[model samples]
Structure formats: structure tokens, C-alpha cells
Target: MEEKQMDLVSLLLRPELPNVQKELPTARYRVKRLSELLDTDVVFTLKGLPYGKVQKLRESMSDDVSVQILLQGCVEPNLKDPVLKEHYGGATPAETVKAMLLPGEIEDLSRAVERLCGYRKLTIEEVKNA
Candidate 1:
């Protein structure tokens, strides 16, 4: 009986692509798993991270400030990164407002989060930054 149930669960969990309406001729971004979005085998988890850091990210996600907060929380030696260190040195939330222009592959960060949010299905949302 357990084996039968396991088989049924596996079938139900398979990934399926949804019918997405493309706004333009160009393809639209689709939510993929975090592992897939990074194009590497690494699996990032938020386990054991500080709640304050995560909350700060959620609050400021609409802005680029969340990126550094995220990196500081999960990615080790985050402040050591020269690029981040130079731009964000003594960085405050207000300072981040003007830093990291052309955040190369900003899409990746957004998409990855979207994908993580939609682990069971591909759910995508686009927000224009003014």
C-alpha cells in the first residue's frame, strides 16, 4: 500500500509548464527552481538565517537594497566582495537607493525568488521599477 501511494505522489509532483501569454514576440520569463535559475548545482536555503535579515529583504525587495541584505545573510564573505564593498561601504538603506546601477542580471535575482515562491508551479509576476 505504501509503495502504491509513493508512486502516486511522484506523478503528482512532476513539473508542468503553464500556458503563459507573451506580451511581445520575445519570450517571457518563466519561474524555475532556484537550482535551475542559477544554472549551477548549488542549492541555497534560508535555514538558520537571522529573521531580521530576512524580514529586511522582504520589506525592501522592491529595491536593490535587498540584494546586499540577502547576500550578507546567506552568501559568506559578502562584505568582502570588492564591488559591493566599494559601492556599499558604510552603506545605509538610503545609500543603496543610488548604488549598484545596472545590477547585471537583476532578472536572475527576481526570477529566482519568484521560482522559489512557486515551488509547486510556475507562477510569474512582473513589476516595473520607476
Candidate 2:
């Protein structure tokens, strides 16, 4: 995984020391609930295809793609019902995942590391000169 993504995963797994216990449970619960919500069934319509053919088409897609299409299909239904909209947050499951990872949710740990290292390196060079 990319460094940024890894950092995000680390942050999700374990936030800063003081908040770790509280944040961990909330994060785990949110991830589990979102996953279950995303796993619900979706019907697909294949052009000019009979039932069996459509089933085959659905089977051909990767799990990720299938879930994406399923969530997209739910948009209209969700829009029509307030409860569904509230549950879905006015966005698809994929979108919900993206929202959770936005800057608001996790610290910029990678950048923080880089800045600390840079400062340390500079201080070392200054000490050597002195």
C-alpha cells in the first residue's frame, strides 16, 4: 500500500496514545457497521439478457465492482426515503469510506514524520558545525 494509505490504516488501528482505547472501539464499530451495510444485495439489469445471462454477468464482476454498482443502484431508492438517506448519508457506501478517511478523520502522520526528521537532520548538521 502507499505510505499515505498505510499511515491512515495505522491511525485507524491505533490513534494517539491517550485516545487509543476510546477511538479504537468507535473506529472498529464504524468499520464493522459500514461493512455490513455495504454487503446488502443489489439487483442488476443486463441489456437484452435473460435471467440466467444476467446472473452470469453479475458473477463476472470483481467483488469491489459489484459492491460499487450495488451501492450506486441504491441511490434512487435512498433519495426517495428519508430514513434510507439518513442511513446512507446522502452518498454511496464507497463514498462513505472516502469520507471516513478525509483529513478530518486522521492526522497527517506521514507529513508530521517528515517534518520531524527534517528538523532533526538540520539540528544534527548545526551541532556538527558548532
* Global lDDT of each candidate: 0.42, 0.36
- The candidate maximizing lDDT is 1
Candidate 1 regions with alpha-carbon error over 4 angstroms: 1-56, 59-83, 87-104, 119-130
Q: What does candidate 1 score on TM?
A: 0.29
Positional deviation of 71 in candidate 1, in angstroms? Answer: 3.4
Residues 1-130 of candidate 1: C-alpha lDDT, one tens digit per residue = 9998999888777766322222111113222442366785443332123445445666767666435543543332233456654676535533442253225333454334333333325456787979
TM-score of every candidate relative to the true structure: 0.29, 0.18
TM-score of decoy 2: 0.18
> For model 2, how does the per-residue alpha-carbon lDDT over 1-130 read when each residue is reduced to its tens digit?
5998999788877734544223211101122333456884432211122234335545775553333332322222332354554565746555453343333222232122223223113544333534
Task: Give candidate 2 misplaced runs (Cα > 4 Å).
Answer: 1-57, 76-130
Worst 10 residues of 2 by lDDT: 20-29
